[model samples]
Target: MAPPKPTAAAMADPSPWRSPAQRGRDRALKREAVLKAAARLFNEKGFHATSLDDVARQLNVTKPTLYHYFRSKDDVLFECCRMGLEMIEAAAATVPGSQASGLERLRALMEQYAEAMTMDFGMSISRTPDTALSPENRAELRRLKAQIDRALRGVIQSGIEDGSIAPCDVRTAAFAIAGALNAIAHWYKPDGPLAPAEIARQTADFLIQGLAPRTSERRQPKR
Candidate 1:
């Protein structure tokens, strides 16, 4: 026997099929999940020791599932490294129009950087070696590294000029600050006693104190 005709409401309602844009968004979200899973594994076990299987297992998916998003482990590592660099770049981008003084801006940058380092992607960036990436990727990572260094130095110089920070070698101070902030990735634990915010605050306070003007300098007459 023939089936009954559909009701008006059923005919008017659209199918549950996802649109192209919705599918694209779903793909993007899945890819980001892969990246985060990979980063966490890479952070826990060094990049060389972490495999696609490990990442997929962490995400409760098969290794082939990762292939749907990334070409290989190297691709995932490169992306994570790029993400870490982008985080620093993003924080640096905010310095120019910040209402705070140069030193305050620098402190803010340090806090942002510290927070990033404690994250999965940033920790992966800290532990992964440049040699693990292809030559081209290595070169790009180096370029970004240099850019971050320059940004830090520029902030220090601005602080020096604004009289918010004590006079010191900008290059030396930048290296010192960056090194300290980057080191957090090596020791920070998600379950540790100190929260990310507290760690960031303490790190920024300690680093900024080194650049703070001395009492004598603070009392000096304006030039």
Candidate 2:
């Protein structure tokens, strides 16, 4: 038998338009693509040196197309930094849920943090200076960074309490770990001698050595 005739409604409008939910998802994806491209450009060339046109050219789109996704170059940079911090925070969050010893968990988190440093968004965080951001954006980034620091400190405190990590100042240790990881963004290049994973592994191992448990006489008082 022949197929039944199409409905009049379907014939008039065959639903070519995306539904609201699909439209929202598409918009989000496009925005993310824009952010990723902007982040890479910002990392390759200093944030001040990279413009919206540069990002648009990299994406093979018009600068006006970027304005649809981001307000301006400053806004794009802020969003890139925000994305980077979120990635680091997400990596750190995994440690609290793991059953590993405090030191092991800390190492895992550090490795993740190092891996993120090699990504475009993550690199953008360290590459962009606070002075480049608007005052409001600068304050917001500092707040997020403080939150990340607290998370790192919490892990250090746990390691110390469990006696898996050397007894020392949590505040100072967290500062050092974060500083080292952030610095990775500065010197790391895709063409670097070591792969990102190898770099991360080596970096984490080096950092963890300082936190390794020590003899009672060797351990310093936990502060």
Candidate 3:
């Protein structure tokens, strides 16, 4: 006798069927993959030198597949910069509500920022300049950048007021700390001797140390 035919449902259903949530998650994952690939290429080749085709080829996807997630190369770069800014902002947000001392909170925030910079999104932010983006994007990026800087400055100010950190020029200190942390994206390598976590710890330690009150200075608190 001939074998029975497959059920209509079985025949129609696709292999590796996904639920609605799963499908949404899959799309999110694919979009992130595109962004990461684009970031890496943009960092290595510079934004102008890297094209959509390069990103697509790097991800083994067609240009149209990229279009499904991003409208253009500029869009991808904008998202990359936005991702970096969001990461820093998220880290900064934790500082205000934490029970830890202001200095401790600042240390945590700095470490978090360093780790973000070590990632692809942060690397793209560091490598790509504001001028590389559209005027609107450039303005948004500058606004986000200023937000992060202001947050850092606020933390420093709090630390000083609370006596957890030494008195210093808050603006200059914020700039110095940010400049150091942002530079990590330029030189950090996944295969480098120091891991991201270790780099974060070390960088935080160095930055925090500068803000530490000297024993002599601590004896006489700033009025």
TM-score of each: 0.88, 0.90, 0.85
Ranked candidates (lDDT, high to low): 3, 2, 1
lDDT of 2 at 12: 94
lDDT scores for all predictions? 0.89, 0.90, 0.90
lDDT of 3 by residue, 75-153 (tens): 8999998998999899998764646778988999999999999998888888888798989888999999999998999
Candidate 3 residues lying further than 4 Å off, grouped into runs, are: 1-23, 96-98, 217-223
How do the residues 1-223 of candidate 1 rate in per-residue lDDT, one tens digit apiece?
9999999998897869999999999999999999988888888888999889889889899999889998988889999989998998899987655467889989889999999999988887778878999888889888999999999998888889989999999999999998899899999998999999999999999988788989977789999
* Model 1 C-alpha RMSD to native: 5.0
Give candidate 3's whole-model lDDT.
0.90
Question: Superposing every Cα of model 3 onto the true structure, what RMSD results?
Answer: 4.9
User: What does the lDDT read for residue 64 in candidate 3?
Assistant: 88
Worst 10 residues of 2 by lDDT: 93-102
